[model samples]
Target: MARSSTPFSLHRLAVALVSCGLGLHAAAQSANPSDSPPSSTALPGVVVKGASEAPLSVGGFGDTPIAKLPLQASIVSAERMTDRGLISLAGLTSLDASVGDSYNSAGYVSYLKVRGFDLDNRFNYRRDGLPINAEAAISLSNKGSLEVLKGTSGIQAGTSAPGGLVNLVVKRPTLELTSVTLAVSERGTIDTAMDWSRRFSDGHGNDKAFGLRVNVEAAKLRPELRDADGNRWLLSAAGDWRVSRDTLVEAEVELSRQSQPSQPGFSLLGSTLPDAKSIDPRINLNNQSWSQPVVFEGKTASLRVTHQLNADWKLQAHGAIQRLVNDDRLAYPFGCTASDGTYYASSYCPDGTFDQYDFRSENEHRDTDALDLSAQGKLDIGGMRHDLSTGVLFSRFRSRLQGQAYNFAGTGNIWGTLPTVADPSLTGTNTDRTERSTEFYLRDAVQLSERWQGWLGLRHTRLHRESWQVNAAPGAEQPTRYSQSLTTPWLGASYAIDPQLMAYGSWGEGVQSDVAPNRAEYVNKGRALPALRSKQWEFGLKSGSRSVDWSINYFDIRQAAARDVDAGGGLVERVLDGTQHHRGIEAQADLKWTGGGVVASAMKLRARIEGSSDASLNGLKPANVPETTLKLQAHQNAFLTGLELQAGLVYEGKRMVLPDNSVAIPGWTRLDLGAKYEQNVGRQLLIWRVGVDNVTDRRAWRESPYQYGHAYLYPLANRTWRASVEWVL
Candidate 1:
């Protein structure tokens, strides 16, 4: 079926854009330029907006505070990501209740799922109010913080999975004079980061100024076991030149590279027997692995121009480019081996002795490039208190994938080890595929009244895909091109109940289109798959005192029109009329005392697939989603010395992945501790910190799918401790 429901979807999109543009013009003309001077010292709305870490910056969406965005939204600050030593996107999402193991596949690649909906990079990301869900992996560096918007984000970040959206805020040059951090952790790891900013003003009648800000971070990340050695380094620089008091130009760039060995992916099986750790732990299978030897790189650069048209109106135009490349290999056992010599295709292993009979050796390579451009501006309506903001975003993404695989069968039972294969020519084959997408969107945030706010958004997106198999028989035809298009809309509202409390609710819709046309499904039926879409609703409360703050929220999300399966074990090539939903609550609190402070957060989630006939698919707990998760922390400054004591505890409830509802797994909890001291001797500065992760040495397991449907678990990184000293100039 066609993705658009309305006969005039394209026309409607045009009208929406025109209406927002007209409203913006009115606001700009009516606003008075003398309302507030454009100066850092001015404690006006602009300064307040800039200082507060709201969800309006790049990689951020939804104005709902971290506590009230969604009962399930999880906010991980820069301090927290570093404290947990989670430097990768996958690591950041692992602990998120909304994005569990369902997206954490065996490969290091990161996928996000919120509210039971899949959120791939294609159309579900934002960076500084810019669309960044391009074809390439969005590399992040010198980030100030991160926010995960729970539920469908059609209003905040159009065309995405209902599961959620992750926004990353980059560090910007500010008036803040200085800040520094240095630390060392488990297994002799070290990290140091610094921030510097300065402003220069022209003495002429023209109020012109220039600012330079630079943030640098370097760290050596070493794994606990042998054969795992890796390092992470980042450099971020941003400079802005205010040509005139009303205009400014800015530029920034980021670079990062990572290299490491592949960890093991062991299957998790459920069984009726009490002694069974897995459904079939005894059925030992061959371990397959792959890794990027040394070269894995990602890069990004952007340029922007900001102009102030008048007191009520301002505009910004931004453009950027990004590129990413990776080369890797995979070695896996395709099936089980018999005691004698032959190979069989099943999970079971015959006889007490195991053997490796079936295997596939393969290599993979990928390259992606993307381009983005957008214009955003804010205006105030004349004679009205309404402040209107509108913008249009355009982006293009392209990707290339090429690979070859070989099979070795009948290689006698050499279980748990690599098997020797004969016949080189018959063992290998190759294939190639390419995908591209183009998206355009316009959104408006309307301040309806002093106590109420509303937002309206619309978007249009198109996707094209093609694939070919080079090793096929001469007469076989390569796949032809396939195309699809979709249009989406969003609505939201917010209200202030009192000085210390506010309540808000939003309903947003998003879509995920197929990478290619379902040729098989087309041949079997008359129509192609419709774009998958999801809807979300959320409400919450916020309250705080002079030294303490807290927030709570409740959310519900639903997804429909998803991929179904057929007899051949391949995607059914058709959309299934099914629904998936999640309901949950989230809470957080921060407190400060005369000499000490505390921070705490907790989550409770319950998700289910509402309508599916398969017993295993019906009501089965969503994979990797813990029913309860909590984190508590306390730190104190020495009353008589220059020392600090810190302690934290984390708890995770049981999680399971099963097709049948009959089998399940239990939950676990863990604790950690640390201490640090600082001192100064002459011209040098010295600081030391010592801590242990998983102090109790608990054998924690994280739900993972190294192979589709074949549950795998990642063991806790292991109990580790380290200490370090630093100096300042």
Candidate 2:
């Protein structure tokens, strides 16, 4: 394991200083209330307005309201996040029917899935519309909102996962604001955050000249498992300078570090699938004495410039770089057991004894860089208005891994108390890989009439990849290299039936580069395959009103399928053949009420439902994908002048545990409740919130079937409680 270059004491000192500064600023502002900016009553981290009424930057097309777009999208505001205590991407699944956890567990790496497809960290994660590696935990303390664009967005994102795209919009500097928040949760967890922003003008006292914002967060918590502890710290800074009336330059930098003891999920024991309800949800299988914690450190920086060439045209350029390192040690259990719970021949326990375990250690480093340049303008052709955008994107990613393995001859049973074991011997480095891609795209939106619009877009992408092993055997082949290029197109049309209703249909294409599986069983390992292509067709209707907003969409998607084929000599190779098809219908609704009635002081309701199916293999459902999903949330502020009540329910239908449809995992549902109180005292605003998740103390599996034949299960946490207080001046 790598040693820490900077001591934890330094981080604690930094946090203390920031907290003191915020307190002083708050006191100063309270003394001079007239200098304070207007306050917002909206619930923190929550979106109270519908998408059609909210302005957003979609697919880098510049700021446009949802009503004018022909796509399915959703925005989760910072206010909503605070209301639910959602601090990571995994928390998003509770509110979004189209997203779910993918191969993720507590106290470990994080991954997400959108629409039954994996959103890879190296290719699909983005911040401020720029790509970033999200394999590690991401801090949300400095973000304004989370935006999701559903379906194929290759024309805008270039090479990406076909499921969808997610962008984190950074919070900008406010003219005058100083906010501090303190939180406590179950398991003795403590969290603190501070946000401050200031605006500066030229000597002439002109506005819109320069602005700066800084946000800091620190948290410590005890893991659900015994003897495991976790902590994290984050700092972010953003600055903007208006060089002139028509030009603006912006820059941002973020640094974060997180560390936690390894906690491994459970994999299937042979062909005999154990009932999830029969196991203890809090059992820690990797808690041997010799185990080492995992630590992640990351740094990111970005710069952007925007210039208005004229009233009809604008130019924008952006570039970003990221670096991350992970130190991990784990004792992973594998292999299957017989009907009598007797283990078979497996690397985890070759003798199938209850007293032995297999352990492994891995250290890795990852780096990424991305650049984008674009031009957008409005043009009038023959009295028709058109919005056009053209851009070029380039990105590169590299990763290196060193691994070692050891066998503990005598450990413990699956459910028995673990026994101490000696530390594993170190093994040399193993794998190194790099990938790069470049793309150019163009898109245009044309208004045919007052109620009719058409859109067209195209993107050409080039991908390159190479991989090699550091410990190759004699006479091994040289490093593998792969390159490919393809062009994808997008078309859409929208028609307004009335002032409040819109109907739209779209057809688009997406592509993803494929790399050979790294498992030892793969015969043709480390060989890159041709890029996979996916096409989608969608139709939807959106309706808006003063009190209600709703949308219903139906989509069909098809993509190339790759499956593993077992060859001789205990080898397996992945081959692409038939195509996989996924079709689904999704519906969403948001309603708010404000009136004088007893039950209508202030109320908000949100709901989502989805039904999906796999049409590629005789209606066989895909692994880890539920056929149906539903979510409902409500908030009301009529009980008291300063109090609000919130509650929500989430449900997921049965899902397949394997690709062949031989086994299935039962569906589950959870309930969450929260409340908040807001009051003003001496020119300062104070808000207090409390929430409980999984109110029923349900024990269930959260995710499964990440690999083709592996039915690894990720368990959900038990009932957890959270409370927080915030002061703004």
Candidate 3:
């Protein structure tokens, strides 16, 4: 683990500052009743000054809650994130429906999934308004908050997979100073974080706006899956300056480093093991564990810029570059050896043959480059108003995997010694694949009258993919593959039932054509690439007041051209004329009690997957999706004398592992409790907090890493305890 070189913990300070700032700001702003503008209520939902674009919320897609999106959307907040003791991005999928977790082939390193969709794809990720994905696993682990939008959101998120997209919102610096937290848990785990934010802006003085935020975090965890362990160190900073009153520029940057040792598999996909209490020797959990014999490391660096143009118009540009290095080789373990000289029940490879497996040793890396520019503004014409937003996005995603394989002819042990391996000349299987996607889109929300509203959106996307494979042998001609193109459309409508409620519906089409001249296209000869689209129906009531807020929604979503493989082992996933229906009900309510000091928030959700026979996924239980889910929370801070107290609870329903419909899992419930106290030390002050997680030690299985047949449950952490103390400066 890299040692922290920073002066203090930034994360702790940032969180405390941001939380307090927002809370106090809201209170202060509400108290000043005379500071109301022309459109007071409308501006509340439009805190993101300058312009409104697409009616899509940056915190989550659309104005609805995660559970109320036209499709199922689940949101995990930063506060819940830390309280749940999440260690990696995979941890966020625990309560989500149809989302799975995987420990990737490299081991220890994990990835998340929703309905078997490759959500880690770059296009599916977004921070604020910027889009990105982790080329390496480390980036996924350090995220602060995540919102998983289930089903196709191509109309809003642009070109991408059809299953779902996880939009991770990173933590930012705030105007708070001095915050700290420390924790120790089972498995010799330890973590510490600190954050501090200082504002030079003058709301109390000369009005010269300036602020700086710094965050630092580090942790060490020994996972239960295997003998492997991981360590991470992170540092991030942000600064903002106001150029006069109409223009402002803010720059943000982050750096992180992570390293972990090799470990065995913790989850399984399909296993023939018997369901006995204490039986089945062949069902060993580590039977399929593949180890990487070398150590691994990953690093990331990013910079973002935001500028405000005017109160109703603004232009922003953002660019980021990243490099990923995996310095290790996969080694087949001896434990996987079968007594009869066979590996598992799969006949793909006999006892110790090389061609049957993709095991190899080598260095692999990927470079990511992205630049996105967009403008958003609002135009109000008398009683008629137009909330318009437009933007262009360009991204380059590239990866290179070059390594050596042993025992090509199945004749040698091919151990530590570097063997001649394959004729490296034939470019057996090494390539640099680069994909670039450019998109231009515009969306306008037109309010024609007091009760009627309409939205029009259009997006044109062009995807170009290129790959070059070079062989190590002399005169080996390298191979290159390239392809380009796709377009999408969107529309929506809403009707106001009263001052506090509204009902709306939307329809959109998303497209993704294979941009490469792969075997599928070459074999079919320009017959066109695979494409998928979604037709969605939604209706809901949104209404609320200062003391109570609530919303309810019902929706049906159908997808076309879903991907599915054929018996010939070919890309048989074609555009089948089939419809898969996902219908659900969701509602959220928050009540403020105890003299406006205590608040109670609760959410209920239920979802299902119904597929048509024509889609080849007829009865398959929509992979990694849960059939039902529910959550309830109650948070309150009461001041009695000089101390404050707080408490909360969370629950999750049962989930499924695969789309095969062969297995079912039970539900799990977890509880969290915490409290804080504060006092004065001369002119300075001190605040203390303590909390406990998983008070029940429930044996919960995380649906992620569902590949292996093991009971792949993400067991609740054994009653973790934490304590923190901060000084208000």
Q: lDDT of all predictions, in order shown? A: 0.54, 0.73, 0.51
Better of 2 and 3 by lDDT: 2
Off by over 4 Å in 2: 1-50, 267-277, 336-363, 403-412, 420-423, 473-478, 518-525, 567-571, 595-618
Ranking by TM-score: 2, 1, 3
lDDT-best of 1 and 2: 2
Error of 3 at 457 (Å): 2.0
Ranking by lDDT: 2, 1, 3
For residues 383-437, write the lDDT of model 2, one tens digit per residue: 8898999888899989876655545535454563657565565533366789888
lDDT of 1 by residue, 318-392 (tens): 776655555433233334455554644322234322222322222333433344444445556753344344455
Tens digit of lDDT per residue, candidate 3, span 1-729? Answer: 443422133334334433443344345345433455566455344222111111234422224342222334556666556544555666654444345554443234556654444454556666555566554454433344676665566655656665566666656555566656565554566777766777785575644488777777787855443334567677777667765566666666667666655432222222432122222211112222332344334444455555567777767676766666665433322223344564442211232222212255456777767777777777888767887777887878788777455322222221222222322222245656777878887877788887888877787777777665544456432445445556676676777665444556766665555432323323332234555666556555544334444445554456554433353545443334455545444444444443333322222223333455544455344444554444444555565644545454445455554445455555566676766667788977766666666666555543433442323333344455665565566
**Alpha carbon lDDT at 59, candidate 3:** 27
Using alpha carbons, what is the TM-score of model 1?
Answer: 0.77
